[model samples]
Target: MLNTFSLVGINMGGLKISLLGSLMCIAVLPACVGLKPSVEEQVNARIEAYWQAMIQKDYEKAHGFLSPGFRLKVDKFVYRNRFAGKTSYKAAAVDGLSCEEERCQAAMILEYTVHGVPPYGFEFNRTEERKELWVNVEGEWWLLPKK
Candidate 1:
């Protein structure tokens, strides 16, 4: 008993089989070939965006980058006050990033100018290096709380 169809000289499920194979390849090929950027790259991009939000003095936007757990422990008001009018970055960079599964660690360098000083009466620039941890939550990457 033959239960298969043929089309255009192809057999055994014919166009249906061909279409299914094509869809399978489309779904799985990228994962096999590593077409997507490395996890580190993705983590670095998230870290960069987070810093950019801070540099722009958009505390509300920056707070969005924190992990759900961190947000639960620290509310918006506390987060905003932590950086409000006290920090301004001239430049920022992600020096390194490493990740395993949903967890990532990043080293970041920020060049910033502090705006007010009682003695100096003028802004002074400084460079600071810090390490940040990140987590992938619900398909989105977020910064973890600092230790």
Candidate 2:
């Protein structure tokens, strides 16, 4: 009793074993090698995107990154209102991150430029490190905004 199959366009017979198992392994190797990013990478990517949204002043977009729990409590209108008229975000970048299980803390640097304070025509640039917590909920990483 033997099964026949083709491998690399070559037909082989009289072998009791099929190359199907080998082919399946080869097809699935990429998944084992991580077709999707690791947890840390996912959190880091989300952190970067969240800051980019804030930098773009797309509060609605940034709001989308907030944890589901937070979103449920704060509507987009309130979230968007929190940033209205006050301008400070010039740039943002993820500096470091640590993760364990379903939680992560991301350290980011926020850049700012402020003008007309104390002096009528003086402007200043500032940068600060900000830490944000991210959590995995329903297999998706989202920012955990402080309520």
Candidate 3:
């Protein structure tokens, strides 16, 4: 009973509505009915994601995990240079990750091997201490300064 152009317009409107509904579902589903992840969990996830990003040389993604103050002082190029390409530095393996909310300290040891002179294959393991701070801003925990 409908003319061809009218039918086409109706189909187009329906398609747009369907697309908007899909987008709204995707956007809102994760935000409802949850207490939201805790600070420690968020930090751990960020650290893991950061390491993965670093391993893949995804500097932009890795930079997101850094504190805002740190990010402001250091650019992406500087961050990449500091972390990438160390002849002495092999790879980092995280172990025994723990978080203390009261102390605001997340502890993890990076297992790594450094190349030695003459014999480059000599494997050695070292644990490096990393100190990270967590601050809450506007009800969201960020790995950044409070101010």
Candidate 4:
């Protein structure tokens, strides 16, 4: 037979546990909310950084943006060589980006000056639009290899 005082103490203990649990959730919930940038923003930022690295001829840094699967398929040497001696762009912009779950696609526009041969020598500005694929792996976004 439990005494009245003992029953009251047990009830208080349960109440204290419940109160502590609720307080813990209250303290932790906000920190988990809005702690990271949205997926679209993150993808766009990563793409921007990749283009910047390329423009600066930092092949090693640009290679870091490639997806793990892509990197596995194509080593850094091959990746760098592909872009070596490529046409240089005067400006680049990420026109738009859309994300769905773990995958994202971005549209980019690059502006460059095309130089003609000496005989027909003429310089003209050209713009090209490209679609890029990206994937999110373990919370970090990476660009997929070009097909």
The clash numbers for all candidates, in the given order, read 0, 0, 0, 0
Tens digit of lDDT per residue, candidate 3, span 1-147?
A: 000001001112211112342244345633233646444445545555555565466777777766666778877788776645442222332333344553234443343344343546564545465555555444444455232
Ranking by TM-score: 2, 1, 4, 3
RMSD of 1: 17.6
CA lDDT of each prediction against the hidden true structure = 0.64, 0.65, 0.45, 0.63
Better structure of 1 and 3 per TM-score:
1
Better of 2 and 4 by lDDT: 2
Residue pairs in clash, model 2: none
Give model 3's TM-score versus the native structure: 0.51
For candidate 2, the lDDT comes to: 0.65
What's the TM-score of every candidate structure?
0.67, 0.68, 0.51, 0.66
TM-score leader: 2
> Model 3 off-target regions past 4 Å?
1-33, 87-103, 115-125, 137-147
Q: After superposition, how far is residue 52 of candidate 2 from its true place, in Å?
A: 1.4
Candidate 1 lDDT tens digits, 26-142: 566443356874565456556656776777777888899999989988888899987676657655555556678999877666677787767767877677777778999998899
Positional deviation of residue 131's Cα in model 4 after best superposition, in angstroms: 0.6
Candidate 4 residue 116 Cα shift, in angstroms, is 8.4
